[model samples]
Target: MLRYQWEDAVRFWNSKKGEDSERVGISSRQKQKFTHTAGSRSFASVAEAEEVKSGQKVGRLQLFEITHRKKDGSPMTSEAGEIMEKLKDKKAEYEATASTDSSVNLENIDNRIITEVLGPERYSRVRFQGSGVTLTQYFGSGSQQYMPSGSQAKAEVQRLRDQMAQMQANTVE
Candidate 1:
């Protein structure tokens, strides 16, 4: 029965191999035939041609065209011109307001807001001086200390215990 099953499997594999050989497969060159035409041209030149055909501008020219022209591609009307002037004035006003708000001196900011944001302990330590504050003043000047690990830590603990024991003994005497 096992020999019959092995023979059947071998026949199935031979049939599949024969079917694959009979079928036609596309070559890599045929698959990329269309891409070869476009790829022959520089990408930028092709893109520029497409943009010009579509009535679109490139980069800063596009931005200028958009701002200057009406949405329907007609020249700006008198009413539209007035609206654009109003928008420009509003924009200038908004920028002036923003500049004034941002230019406020740090010293002019209320202590209450600073205290609330920083919390009491941090606020006390970080009280801003006009000359400029150093990070060391706010968070200690000490560098991070290395801690012993494993056997070293155990030895250190034992040494500390021995010193404490000696001190206790002396106090008792």
Candidate 2:
């Protein structure tokens, strides 16, 4: 995994590079901080977290901080509940639409789901949105694909659900 400085990420996103790169730096709005604490979530190891400091200009999605901690205090699972529901719906939809005439390859299935389920901004994380993917890779093709097993998938779904529940809990308070 590569360590990206928040300011550098901002510069990359803002398209201001090298000497031409504005010294003024990226605005906080354009950068997001990923931290860990109660009622918080982070998708990074302790070392990774240490590498990044708060108030640093991380990129749009370069850093993920879970707003809610698990029982063990880890990332809040990068999974999305709505996406899982949609995945179920998609599987059903595929079965329903499955036909002798219908020819759907893995790539086709993945692309369709990615396009429909995730809009432009959210679509970047193509792994969860797609049918099968190497979970390890961040939307990249690899030999050792990281497709989640049944238990792993279940855990992720549960984490997403718990996060939502926590958000709801916070909103109520």
Candidate 3:
């Protein structure tokens, strides 16, 4: 999968042998292929990209990107708490408007892994979001209910999906 700002947008294709080889180290050939594939994408120019394993439990390296809107800002901090806070209110109208005018538009897309893959339990405990960004855009609110991984998880994810879709739809051209 190729993720841009946490959105799963593109599909990555690689040979099984290539995938296996990357477990040890990426070959020059593989590197070239990755560069070519990533470079050809629409988000290639502005989005910072990295190779992420499928899940915390999985090891298949996949592409994930984070678009930087402000060139003046320093690289994102690596601290987990800071990352969560940075991502806390990125969707605010003022922030979004400021970002859209920049050379690189900053967009934090809907990420289903927070529910479908990680489930609510793991999602609540995890502090990080997206890949390659120095800071994350979303914080874990922590679980309120006893078992967030149950139907509650699905509901939360669905709600977020709807919210994100509405936000996207309302974006000013």
Candidate 4:
């Protein structure tokens, strides 16, 4: 896996090495540090809290700190800094979506109920809207997908209940 990654990176680097090509100098240390802490939700949350405490309403996402160095341990070029900034912006956008969109609060719903009734596959498709506490089930394929409601949703829920009952009855033996 590492070999494949190394080869792919080398291939990418080589492709960018033309007369007019400006290289982005990213050091291994920076890469290691970024990889180590990039996905840490707790770290991001703490940083965000600290920013809020400092009276900043909205703060830049500190996804990764780019060290001003190149692949050869030289100073970073302007092109590299620009690239890193772009990367940071992209990461912030993704984190923003992940933190906001459909972060579930199964406070009133139990995991056992979900597993026994709806099954694991349907769990991801279920969105619990907080306003009216509506359970919107996205059904069918990508562009053709639609939310199930009214009689369709009721019938599906009933079917799941029946399945759960049958499973419980069998378990009693």
Candidate 5:
């Protein structure tokens, strides 16, 4: 796959079965091609052009990059403690701004998987805040949750059908 057209041409020229001229090697053909490349260029100029640079050094400088990320497959380090601290602050702020009727529990959710996997420190940080960067922007506290594939579709469709039925009932009679 990596072989080039010039290589095949050179091979064909070298291995002519019926022809009987004194054989020409690929290097000689390449030399001739290089010599005849441009008008007004001679063999001496060609020899000078092929000269290797003197005292060349292939020196190198080492470089590396560090990465920070979260691991979730098996048991991993928890950010729960840091999360709880921030959540408490956010809850207080929300409570102050919200009207009396807002039903935000401001309580820790009891999830065995989260607690077991993350430990108290990290498990405490994860909560179902509204969708946005607000929950993750401060202190880099970002958490993503996933469930069965069809569950979301089923739930959304059920909710929409219920809403449509309610709207139709309101319009009737």
Candidate 6:
């Protein structure tokens, strides 16, 4: 999906006319960074975070810093800093466990970090929104190739259920 989004962006930029005729170029590395951040909801590694921080003209260290800082460049309170530090430590612990334990799924670590950052309520909303979008996109495109309409889809599902019931009845005999 990210690849498709990247391709669509490239296509749109390349299609510009007039003064914008000089096609805008985006690097593959930038796309990779975008995909990594979007997919994992975090940077691929601390090195990648530093690389991003170096390229930023403003908001340096914003990735690791909580947003409750004052305009005077001081933390709102020591508690905010402490909380962020604890979260960072937890993230590091998860990464270490993932590295040492072959059975650890990296995606689970990402989900855990996102859930921690967003909290349970917001995290659930985000998950629901994602699922809604996925289902909408799939049915919008997939229906055109499979069942043409909602009635047909319902009919097909009913037909499958009936077939399963018939098979069960035959097996009982």
Which candidate has the top score in lDDT?
Answer: 6
lDDT (Cα) of model 3: 0.35
For residues 1-173, could you state the per-residue lDDT of candidate 2 as single tens digits? 24567776766767745435454344542353322243222333432443465645432122222222355645443343345456557656655544422332233344444445544324234422222323335434651232434654465466569879999999999
Report lDDT (CA) for all predictions. 0.43, 0.43, 0.35, 0.42, 0.35, 0.47
Predicted candidate 6: what Cα RMSD to the true structure?
Answer: 19.9
TM-score attained by model 3 = 0.19
Candidate 2 lDDT for residue 13: 61
lDDT for 42 in candidate 4 is: 46
Off by over 4 Å in 6: 1-66, 70-74, 108-110, 123-173
Better of 4 and 5 by TM-score: 4
**Which numbered prediction scores highest in TM-score against the true structure?**
6
How do the residues 1-173 of candidate 5 rate in per-residue lDDT, one tens digit apiece?
A: 44798787667657754133434454465454111122354323333343333333211000000001123322112343333444445445545523442332322222222233334433233322212324245224434222212544464466569879999999994
lDDT score for residue 37 of model 1 = 22
Q: Mind giving the per-residue lDDT tens digits that candidate 3 earns over 5-56?
A: 3352222225566566666475555443112122334442322333232323
lDDT of 1 by residue, 1-173 (tens): 69999898778658977456445343544443112122354434544665688877443223223344555665355543443354455445435533655432232122322333333333233333212344355344731211123554465466569879999999999
Q: Judge candidate 5 against the unseen true structure and give its global Cα lDDT, from 0 to 1.
A: 0.35
User: How close is every model to the real structure, measured as TM-score?
Assistant: 0.20, 0.27, 0.19, 0.20, 0.17, 0.31
Report per-prediction Cα RMSD to one decimal. Answer: 29.1, 16.6, 18.1, 20.3, 26.7, 19.9
The candidate 2 region of ten consecutive residues with least summed lDDT is: 59-68
Candidate 6, residue 92: how far the Cα is off, in Å: 1.3
Q: Write the per-residue lDDT of candidate 4 for residues 1-173, one digit (tens) a residue.
A: 69999898777667746312433344434453223222334444644564677766322222223133444644355544554566455555435533554332222223223233324433343322111221343333442223333554465466569879999999997
